[model samples]
Target: MMYISELMTGAPTNERCPLERRMYETLDKLKIPYERVDNDPAASMEECAEVDKVLGTEIRKNVFLCNQKKTTFFLLVMPANKSFDTAAFSKKLGVSHMSFAPPEKMLKHLGTTPGSASVAGLLVDEDDYVQVIVDKEVAESEWFGCNPGINTSHLKFKTQDLLQKFLPKIHHRARIVDL
Candidate 1:
């Protein structure tokens, strides 16, 4: 059985990776209240369902993508259950030939590896290199759930806090796309 800790408010008491710690620090700095849980690394959306139960909200699916030239990078957050259609996403966004960004780029830009990417990663994107694309459904949801830059830990907070406070404070605006 998957091990999931009880729903707890705020950051972990013990040491965490720099990225994860930064996530909590940023949120706390912004006064954006959140709930979190520590669990085994969940590599897939299906596995996140268990964490969702504890969080009381579905975890959003965060994908790091780039254009063909890799010049234009994006961090897209969509409904966890929604399938990602790259072609359709590209069409909707008016970008061409969008593909999953390489792991190195994901690390360099988002500060997280595959299966561990989240909007929290945007806190490290100080240069505003990664364009944040949030699905309409996700943006409208009352609560947002995502990893704190690691799959082993997850966080849930008010969607308003993310859209209105977090992104703006980080100087990254969310481009809400219907997909």
Candidate 2:
């Protein structure tokens, strides 16, 4: 795990990643204040839970999914403790055969690795290729947390600001579902 301090010699500033730096720059432009914490590269929901502890806020589970043809992509955000039922999700979304999007697809579309997927990544999605769905339980919370384009750094911000302010700028509409 790499700490935010290690990545920054002083205060944070806008920076570009290998692919696109839109995510970092977007937050700066929006002036959304946040705090970052470093943690291990969490591979599963349980591992992410451990990382959440260090951030002092529960990180929502951001799942990258696709349809059978891999044409349509979706970003489902839910509480870390919530379970994902494919059947229920498929029915809710009115899609046939929804599965996890491949790592290559994630990188190509969102410029993020598997364990580092965050709604913040939407800044780079110029095509609007993915639909953002946030669990109702998560949306109702006061604070939301996620990675800042890196697994080692987690960011905390106001849920209202993320949904009401940041999301609108990215042209993202979050569907609050039961799952």
Give the count of colliding residue pairs in each prediction: 0, 0
Tens digits of lDDT, candidate 1, 32-82: 999999999898999999999999999999989999999999999999889
In angstroms, give how far residue 10 of model 1 lies from its true place: 1.8
lDDT of 2 by residue, 1-179 (tens): 43233222122455435433455566667887766655556666676676666666898889899999999999999898888998799999999999999999998887888888888678768789989998988999988988766665667888988998889988887878877
Which candidate should be chosen as best, given lDDT against the real structure? 1
| Pairs that clash in candidate 2 | none
Off by over 4 Å in 1: none
TM-scores for candidates 1 onward, in order: 0.98, 0.86
The Cα RMSD in angstroms, rounded to one decimal, for candidate 2 relative to the true structure is: 3.1
Model 2 spans with C-alpha error above 4 angstroms: 1-21
lDDT for residue 69 in candidate 2, whole number 0-100 = 98
